[model samples]
Target chain A: MTEQRILHGADMLTERGRAEWDAAGVQVSALVDNPYKKDFPLLATKPSLAFLDSAATAQRPAVVLDAQRNFYESMNANALRGLYKLSVEATEAINASRAHVARFLGLTDADARDIIFCRNASEALNIVASSYGGSVLAAGDEVCITIMEHHSNLIPWQQVCERAGAKLVYMYVGEDGVLTEEEMRAKIGPKTKVVSAAHVSNVLGVENDIKLLASIAHEFGAVMVVDGAQSVPHLQVNVRDLDVDFFAFSAHKAFGPLGIGVLWGRHELLEAMPPFLTGGEMIDSVTEQAAVWAPTPEKFEAGTQDAAGIFALDAALTYMEGVGYEAIQMRESALVHTCMHRLADLDFVRIIGPADPALHHGVISFNVCGIHPHDVSSILDMDNVAIRAGHHCAQPLLAHLGIESCCRASLAFYNDSADIDKLISGLQHVWSMFHGD
Target chain B: MGEGIYNAALMEHNAHPDYKYEMENPTHTHEGVNPSCGDDIILSLRVVDGIVEEAAFTGSGCAVSQASADIMADLITEEPVEEVKRLCELFLAMIRGEACEEELEDLGEAAELKSIALMPARVKCAELGWRTALTIIEEEL
Candidate 1:
């Protein structure tokens, strides 16, 4: 007989707490079958687990974790604050990481200085909404965005428009999930000053034609802002190619350390906009009554930055580079295709976003007919299949789509067929658990 | 691994909640919302003097929220004011695993949701109706 272990709880879920493992290990017979699965420690340890919420946050690889530890072990100092060797090294690490991110996004080395580190994409977007929008926006002007914006992009503009006495406009999508040019033209008129959109929808997994949106915004003499939080992980997004005025993304969503986000703006725009935050190291010179701020990136990075997270982001970009865009896209496409086909096989399942699986960029949202997503999610959890079951922070989009909540299973290149199969079976189990009587 | 957790009492209460209806001009009403899960309920109570004349709820939510609302509405209706408050306190405490065996026994069928304390994610769902009921009647008392 093989020895087994029981994990106790003050009041363990009699059902879920029944996870018992034999001498080999916890659910050894049920470990996920994927080469990439081994790279993520959480997936590897929880072998039967299928994490399909990359749009929320992706799991970190060993290299990214090591990069964070190495930064603290070797040279953990405040960047741009001291002349000591350790501090200099920290500053250089941040500079190198910024350059790496710029190059990854196809920005010129000179444009590297335009990248500002913030808490996350939400904060990055808030900076633009406050500093840039606060400066350019005037009464009676209009700020146009899509009905499908994540709350991070939507709320900032909504509040900014309200504060500036400007009207907030929206570009609606058809049932096909595409924002037509006619709608764009109607909404983005001469009075429109800002046009912000998500490059990829976190809920729909549909890619918006941001290049076209940027051109139209430019035609109207408006600046375009792209929320690349969802796009950066799945696609090869080039900032210069898209030609948007500002771009924002978070590091944690790209398999990097937490609390690190990037906001890249045109150098001239960033230079003219007042600082979003005020503090030490962001100023060139300070007096009792007045202060001269530092140039570009440093002017925006006010407080003590996340030095270790910045250094670790360098590893994340390097890892993505090593994987190459072609391979990442191909692998993720196959996963999504297989998943969509299998889910369609279940008649009870109704997909929420784009009907075409090919159009999805590593994300899928659906609902089991007549069953609440929260209940669906709880049943799936019992089988160790994780998914997001809520409004996805896009209340406007959900209201527009006429759904209170949905189940989103976003994939990354690391996910494999075993994860998809487990998810399908878990969903079937959910259906039967509710109706098996 | 166990069977009783999902079937019968839980699923029946959710699928066919008899008390899920809007009360006409209720004596007290409150909207309970679990923002994260999108669980929302408008709990309505019709009270006369010191006794609850009727209790009902109208909303959408997960199985736990819907079932718990229906169950709580069924148990609290036609009960005295002070007795209703005691039952609500007992039910909430029982779901939280803080109430003793005797207090849990006083909770009637709501004690079936005791497992929710272990399932931390659903604790809010189970407490939605009781919390709303407590808040609506709290000021008057």
Candidate 2:
């Protein structure tokens, strides 16, 4: 058992901590922590901590921070309403942000107006479920999704199907942690109206073939929507190349600010759907009895906008591009490879996803045998190693796997071999604590 | 080892607990779930003639929840129902670190759990059984 400390000292990276980390192989000179860690202020200041919960939310870089402050300091106004110069500047800033987000999603056929800003990815999904799904779905019609979907994507379609008297169908995966083509063909048939699934499972850490799914759905004349909350942060997603009708992701998960999200739909689709929320600025013309809605993006973005967050999201996309997708992909894959191998070496640990280490993209979920995930996470916390415990918001997948919950250690480009080493020592500490050393 | 939440006593109760079993013909039974962590418990109590004749739980949860439930069953069984309810309240307070020295002494084996207060995230884990027991009693009234 670890000796109980009477006091939690501040400034964790002391002389002794440096010595201890060195002894634990955390300070290997040839293999150091990422050069990008300094870009994120929290990682730079804390130094010794290993933050492994990037799937929930990522650390924002200094450029994103500066963009948020610059928005507030320079042009702080309700966008698209006033005739003043500051209001126009705010509107232009948001417009610029919309263009940037559209390009980030590779909106080749669509322009800035097709990009809608909601509170988060959940809200964006709800908009599609309420507006397009509510209009298209009818009795006996079916909506198809995978068994491995986050609650955000699942619940919206569920409620819409229930309200429209439509059937909700789920496609299942085999032991390999991916959906097969035959399964997709069998589930999405002529009765399917809409198809929605996560581009990558939050728990399984397997990237679903969105392009294949889109082509299959199109064969049956079903429109496709994608939950890119996990994919956008790790992989390069081109919505046009995939040909999905609508895609959604949260800004916070993409190393941007909170309280803002992106929902990019094809231009014609966005133009055809009715407004999701109606209020002050979304009106093109208004009367006491009736009203007219503004265009596609404005019709969805009702009420006051988070102009600062939008501006910050633009900067986040820029920062990610500056790092380049190829570099981010390479670094994260190497980190996950190292992380999974080290965790698999532990006798008590059981990796939940595919056996092949290359299959895991940027996330990995595992269980500590005979130990509760919460207990495992609690012990790891003592070592300043953070991990996510619980269902990872995918209860259906966990239930299918016959486990209550598991601990997830997701990675980003900023993590390195040092974090993996810390996690290895942390799990060993946990197992030794439960079963005497 | 004695100061932390995972003390020898708690670990013993978690590994080989006397209170983790099914109770047939239980007088009061209720299921409780901690939605945050997905920890759940099916608390069964056999209260007869104003005394808790037996108390048992059939469920799965973390070590803190399981051990805490077992220790609570050990303290409250064969005791008056009113005293059981009182001890449940005190156990909750002790887990929150709200009990003084005198009140802590009254809790017996459960008092060793006062160190759980240091972990704000696991506080709910320690209180799961006590909260389930309290709910059963309150529903009876």
Candidate 3:
């Protein structure tokens, strides 16, 4: 058997093209199977490997990897711990990363002081839900969110509402998988104490009207918290302009290292809100009887930080800035648009979310009639076409659609038209195998 | 994939299901679902003269699950009532790849699915039909 190479920029549906892609995808998988890279090695060794599961985790580039390595190799000290050169360097790196993230979100240095680092966006949301729910939420108040939230965004609020006497209210998304501004306004009223929503739904990919929602929440004196996990990675976000009281996102989703998250709160609000986690780094001074906490970001940080991961995140943001967020967004949007057109034309295939590309970002979920999502996913995998299957951690949305699961192919700036072609070809093969076409 | 893992004839039966719709007057019917992967199966059975006269199934899931149910139906229909119960036991053992020589003979092509043991995620899919059959038999008894 001759070893085959999948040619880049080739139409994947052609016989030679598909074989090449399959070979390439397998090659990439083999490369990723090894764990001793010590650097940002391709998750899969093969450049031709088709990985369509960006919704789960985006692949990190070499720049992000080098940043983390450089940090550990040089200034590997606890931030704010000592006056030594290494410690000062580590502290400066931490502050610089914070500033980079703040500028990326269009927040000032003072606003950056309110951005606390956590484990992931899920933990960031939990910090607000647990801390704010404990201090601010009273009996009879309602927390408003939409139907299309991941369990991470939903469960914490549910727990908070259960602990306090507060109620959890959800604004319903229409059949098109979009929540109307009117629907949001109706759901948020004087009783609504907090309004939290995903800026772009992880499953549907429909970008919500956050600025309008923020205004409505403000009208009712409720704090608006936006889950930027899906949005921050794909689009250029200006939290200051949107006026969201708190914003949360994961660095890994934006091609950064894992185990690092950002929780951006208003400076005054963070000062007033109690810290959820109490530990060494977050304290101002500790006495036998009483302890005062540090201000804003430090107060919320609580423990020794993920210094290396934070530095890597700053590198990730720098890469995005060099590429230009607008350009990345446009490229991904084009890829998604092409995917929607190709998949929607297939018989028995139904795209799951809003049909308008202008209304959404780069995520697409769909189901092939008479074919289980698992079957579709496995067949695609056999051809090295990676995609996500299941409810995507949004069970309520899946239940609403009367479907248990759907296959999702999410894209990033690194992906191009060739990826979409591979996905279409894989789906065609699955359709033929099932229907004997 | 091992031939001993799942009955090839059974998988074929699943792919080309014979009695896949509702039985006109089923003696009993049971719905089983795998919550983890969201596979659902509804098994309908008609027993006559202490034997399963007919078995039909309707559901949505992966090919392994849907096909497994079809194979299970083909194996037990029109067999002795006690024999059907014994066959169910053998099928469960086969899924676990624990069927002895004698037990393998009873399971027939269903034994070919032994490779399913290696793919733990597909175990529930392969057993969905068999589980429903057991539920129906237990309900009748």
Candidate 4:
């Protein structure tokens, strides 16, 4: 018995080669199939099931799952409480995980001490906005965010402004979906208390120049806060190099467990700011009248921590590091380029954001002519290809573009060129069916 | 077939739609849209002598909705405008899995869409065409 061998060449894109390529691309068995993966029971019954909705919630690898199981099976004790062996072991493991995450993000041990665990990115952002609004921001102060921000990033600032009598300002995204340095500078004025922006636009896949934005915020004495929910998972991010005052992202988005988020702030800022949630673990000494609070990160983490989730997050980060961020970024960028080129050939398809791979990451949002995004998505589902539709929580940005919704195919490290081909073929079918051509 | 339930004929027709094109000029036109799935259906009808003589549907949607629309336009024409309304009511009941045996016969092939009740998300797609028919009939009335 002989095994079959697949070959690749430079002429793979040629017309004669395309048929073979397309066949290779669309054939379900040739690609990775997860029939036994019962983790997603909802997808079990789906006719043609391929999970491409990683941007919404990435599927957890087995290692991350094991890490969570191991945590509960062996080290099941509350952290930082008793002087017993089990308590000390749990506390050490939690702190070590924090240190590992800090190092992964280029933070020093002292800087890692400033990292606070929260429920998710939304809660983390609110912690900063609410705490800053109460302690630092005053009446007439301004909070600047970008037009491409997710509602998670924008709404908190809006509420903060309304409560503190501050104004929320937005920087506009140009036709290309990239915010220019001039536009960023113009938005951050003297009264700006905070300049919070997404490192990468989830909808457009446009990568913002964080270094320049941080510098502009620093020039105006405004604290630079970055929502790295989209960026941290796909790119190599260094908090120290960016010189950001605060940064936050969710574990689930990075292929970890859900309900766990990481908030990394400057040591000095975390030390100065008052705790957002005060409870058992966060207290230093409690009396009948008042209580002194624990320092920095512990003060912010008030109640029983998501110990299992945090451990799983550490495993996810370790898995990502093992894969190497540079390789992941390169792989995803190539996938995005292939997707853009394939989609560009279609007459009715319009690729949102910068079409160039250099200007963006793996996220690609587009619309087919005379076809609604939901229809496009549903048609793809029938073909066993999956994608995300609707405003993608960027309603304001979508409204600015005069579109109700657009189809988005976000790629991750696991995605390959075959996935792009599936999307393109699926889209073609959708277009032909809609136009009856 | 009773007036309230969908028949096997109607369900078959919905699965393989006929008369899914526009006439040279339509007496009435209406657009039916489903915001959830963003399914849109534009129905054009030509009524003569109190009868729907010709009908066509032009829109972008899923297979179920588009096929359902095609079937609806074909079945309703050459019938009394009043009976078309009764058929639309019966089709709605069929999709809800509430149409009795007599009602099912009135709905014809549209009754085949009872399988859609199992997939709750697809119920809207199955009903888009019937809803469009009702809209056009309502305007004429």
Give each candidate's interface RMSD in Å: 5.0, 2.8, 5.1, 12.1
Q: What is the lDDT of residue A84 in candidate 2?
A: 99
Q: Candidate 2 vs candidate 3: which has greater lDDT?
A: 2
Query: What's the TM-score of candidate 3 when only chain A is evaluated?
Result: 0.90
Error of 1 at A193 (Å): 1.2
lDDT of 4: 0.77
Docking category of candidate 4? incorrect
Worst 10 residues of 2 chain B by lDDT: B1-10
Number of backbone collisions per candidate, in order? 0, 0, 17, 16
Higher-DockQ candidate among 3 and 4?
Answer: 3
Tell me the lDDT of model 3 at B49. Answer: 79
**In model 1, what lDDT does residue A319 have?**
89
Which sequence of candidate numbers ranks them by DockQ, best first?
2, 1, 3, 4
Instruction: Report the C-alpha displacement of residue A412, candidate 4, in angstroms.
Output: 1.2
- lDDT for each residue of candidate 4 in A1-437, tens digit (9 for 90 to 100): 01121222222233533443343344323223323234333444442455678787777777888889999899879888878988787887788889877987888766668889999998999989988656888899999999999999999898889888989998998778989988987889899989999999989888888899999999999999999999887888998899899999999999899999999998888888888988889988999999998987899999989888888888988888877887676556555555566677777899888866557676888888766676577667766788998778877788787777888888776665455656766776666554544
lDDT digits (tens) for residues A252-283 of candidate 3: 99989999999998888888888899989988
Q: What does candidate 3 score on TM?
A: 0.84
lDDT of each: 0.86, 0.87, 0.81, 0.77
1 versus 3: better TM-score goes to? 1
Please give me the DockQ of candidate 3 compared with the native complex: 0.30
Ranking by lDDT: 2, 1, 3, 4
Two-chain DockQ for each candidate model: 0.45, 0.55, 0.30, 0.13
Candidate 2 clashing pairs? none
**TM-scores of the candidates, chain A only:** 0.92, 0.93, 0.90, 0.89
Better of 1 and 4 by TM-score: 1
